[model samples]
Target: MTFTLGPRAISAGYQLAAFDQIGSTNAEALARARDGERGPKWFVTTEQTAGRGRRQRAWVMPRGNLASSILEVMDVSPAVAATLGFAAGLSLESALQKLAVEANMRRAEPLKFALKWPNDVLAERQKLTGILLEAEAVAGNRLAVVVGIGTNVVAAPEGTPTPATSLAALGVHVGAEELFKGLAEAWVEFRGIWDNGRGFAGIRKAWLDRAFGVGEPVAIRTGTATIEGTFDTIDETGCLIVRTAEGKRMPITAGEVYFGTAASLGAT
Candidate 1:
C-alpha cells in the first residue's frame, strides 16, 4: 500500500513526501529547511537506513518499520520549540491506541501504551517508538523544527538501555502504511491543541494522563551525575520534575531515565 497523508492533515495545509527508503527523514526535512523550504510538510519512509535518536545515539529502522518526520517553520524560541514534542508524543499515542484496539479484537488481554518522559512511546513497558526533535535557525528569526518519529512495526533493536518492543511482536499485525495514516490524522488533532507552543498547558495535561512511570522510583543520568528520585511530573516548560529522597524537587532538562528495577541497577 502507498503511504499517504490523512484527509485532516491535507486539509490543514500539510504536505507529504513519502519514500520507499531513506537515510533519515529528520535529516531530509532539516536539509529542505536549510534550502529555504518553509513548510508544514511530512517526510516518511518504511525502511530507514540511517537514523539517530536522542543524544546522538544511532536509530535503525529495518524494513517494515516506520520512520516519519514533519517540518514546521515558526517564530518561536528553542525553549518553546522543545515543547512541540509533547504534541508528537500525544499524536503517536492516540494512533497506537487505535491500532492496538483493532489488533486485539477477540483477545481478552489488551495491550497498554504510554508516553515515556522526554520522547518515547512505550508498549507493555517496553520502548516501541522514539521521537526526536531537531531545529535550525533560518531567515526572519524563524526556526525550522523537524520532529522525527520512528516506530518498530516489525523489528526491534536488541540490547538497548531500555528494552524495546514491536507491534508485530505483540501480535498487532498492522502495516506501516496503516500506522502512518492514523498518525498523520492524529497529529492534526494534537498539533492543533499544541498551537505552536501556545497551547502547551493543554498538551501537558493530556500528556500526564498517559504518562508512564509517574509516581514510580526512577533515576535520571545526566552528563555530570546520576540523580535517583521518584518520578514526579513534567513542569509547564516540559522539564521532568524529579523529587529526591530529601523531598527536593529537581527539574531536569535532559537525561537518560530508568524506572523501577532498572533505576535500582542504575542502568545508563
Candidate 2:
C-alpha cells in the first residue's frame, strides 16, 4: 500500500498509498477527510481503478498513471466551491510541468497544454488530466474536502466523450510511484498560496500564464441559455472573466465552455 517517492520528493517527506484498484479516490479521500484523516501532512494513493472528477464525471485512470486525492479542510465558502477547483488546477499544472521536464518530454515537441476553466488539463487542446473536488458536511464545525487528480501517464480508454493523451504519448514515461509524491508536494505549495487570505491572485497569475483562450471568442453553456463572449482573464477568486457578446464583463461561476476547438471541448 505504501509507495516510495523519488529522491526529489523524499527530501520533502511525502508519503503515498498505492492502490491496485478502487471505485474512486476522491470518494475514499472525502470519507477519510471526514474522519479527521487529511491535511498538508498526508498524501494518499498513487493510482486508482476508477477515479472521479467534477460533477461526478468518471475520471478514467489506467494502472501506473497519476490517480490520487489530497484531503484538506478549508475555510472556503461552499457557495464558491465551484471556483476553488481552480486552485487544484493550478497545482496540477505545476506538477505536470515538472514531470514533462524530468522525463525529457520536451524533446518530442509535444503540444503545449493548458488549463481549461472549471477543471481539466489539456495537451495540445485535448484533455490530459482533470480534477475532482468532493465535500461533505461534517459534524459540529468542519467540512471535508478531497482533491482527486487523474493524469494520463500511459493511455486513456478510447470512445470517451472527448480526446485524451498520456505522458507517454508526449515522450514522458512517468511511472505511478515516481509521480505521486511530486504531485503531493506540489499541492503543499499551492495550499499555502490558497490559505492566508491570499485568495487566488497567485493561482490566477500562474493559470493565466498557461491558460488557453484568453483572447479568443467563446461560449459558456449555463443550461438555461448560453452566454457567448470573448475570453478575458481570471479574477482573484479564480473565476473566469468573460466579456459577454454585448461587451459586458462577466464572472462565470459554473458552465461548460465551448471554444470551437478540440482541445477546449475537454470533459463530458
lDDT of each: 0.93, 0.68
TM-score of each: 0.98, 0.84
Rate residue 102 of model 1 by lDDT: 67
Q: Which segments of candidate 1 are over 4 A away from where they belong?
A: none
Cα misplacement distance, residue 260 of candidate 2 (Å): 3.4
Candidate 2 is scored at a TM of 0.84
lDDT of 2: 0.68
Regions of model 2 farther than 4 Å from truth: 5-15, 41-47, 79-83, 102-111, 261-268
Q: Write the per-residue lDDT of candidate 1 for residues 1-268, one digit (tens) a residue.
A: 9998878989999999999989999999999999998989999999998899998899979999999999999989999999999999999999998988866786688888999999999999999999999999998989999999999999999998888999999989999999999999999999999998889999999999999999999998898799998999999999999999999999999988989976857552
Local lDDT at 95 for model 2: 74
Question: Pick by TM-score: which candidate is best?
Answer: 1
Deviation in angstroms for 253 in model 1? 0.4
